[model samples]
Target: MNCKFLAIAVAVILFCRPGHAQTGATVLDDFKPSSLNQPGQEYPQVNSQGYVRFRIEAPKAQSVVVSLGLGGTRGGTPLTKGTDSIWTGTTAGPMEEGFHYYHVTIDGGVFNDPGALNFYG
Candidate 1:
């Protein structure tokens, strides 16, 4: 009888403990963007005329394209090599003020910039 009481007590103690005591609740973040292209930044490389310029860093990519809405798809001009694993492109003209999308086309794959903070429809 004493052994039965002890076994029941042990079972109650084990089941009564809070679940968080073993594993706490967690907040999960799904780090997936809706698009492979990135949105334009609020600020770009400004020229003397104060036209904001945009820069896309894709040194590994043989071909990078920036599609500016209404402005058209601008190819990666003056691609320069860098120390890191990347290929870069710059535009001669300042990016027109508006919504834009860009992707680094590498080996026929498009990727979004994790650092960029913009998105397009």
Candidate 2:
């Protein structure tokens, strides 16, 4: 029981740390604070009200899904093509304003969010 409690406590402390700690850098620096939002933009590059957003610099895909976890959200949002093969969308949140892990999925597959820091949760 004591061992279990100790392990639990350690896990809690690590989980409480800002989601970007996995990268060994600050989330603010990771996200480029200055690029949080552009003048007259619909959403922020980083947002509290919405989830993290990203775009890939790849040619148009037959399909794409941005998985929230290192693996993928059991059921995550699928990416819709934006102009120039850019994909965009938000996640089901309850997420605090900070960095989180994610990956891109092309054609019903999952990939790590190469641009963002990743955590196992």
Q: Using TM-score as the measure, which candidate wins?
A: 2
Across 35-121, the per-residue lDDT of candidate 2 in tens digits comes to: 333443432245433345555545657876666532244456565677777676544342455555556778766776545444577
Candidate 1 per-residue C-alpha lDDT over 1-121 given as tens digits, one digit per residue, 9 for 90 to 100? 9999999999998657654221232323222322323363432333332232334556556654444322324444334445774444334343344445654445566666443555668
| Cα error, candidate 2, residue 114 (Å) | 2.6
Clashes of 2: 3
C-alpha TM-scores of all predictions: 0.38, 0.47
lDDT of each: 0.44, 0.53
Task: Give me the overall lDDT of model 1.
Answer: 0.44
Highest lDDT model number: 2
Clashes in model 2: which pairs?
A: 102-113, 103-112, 103-113
Clashes of each: 5, 3
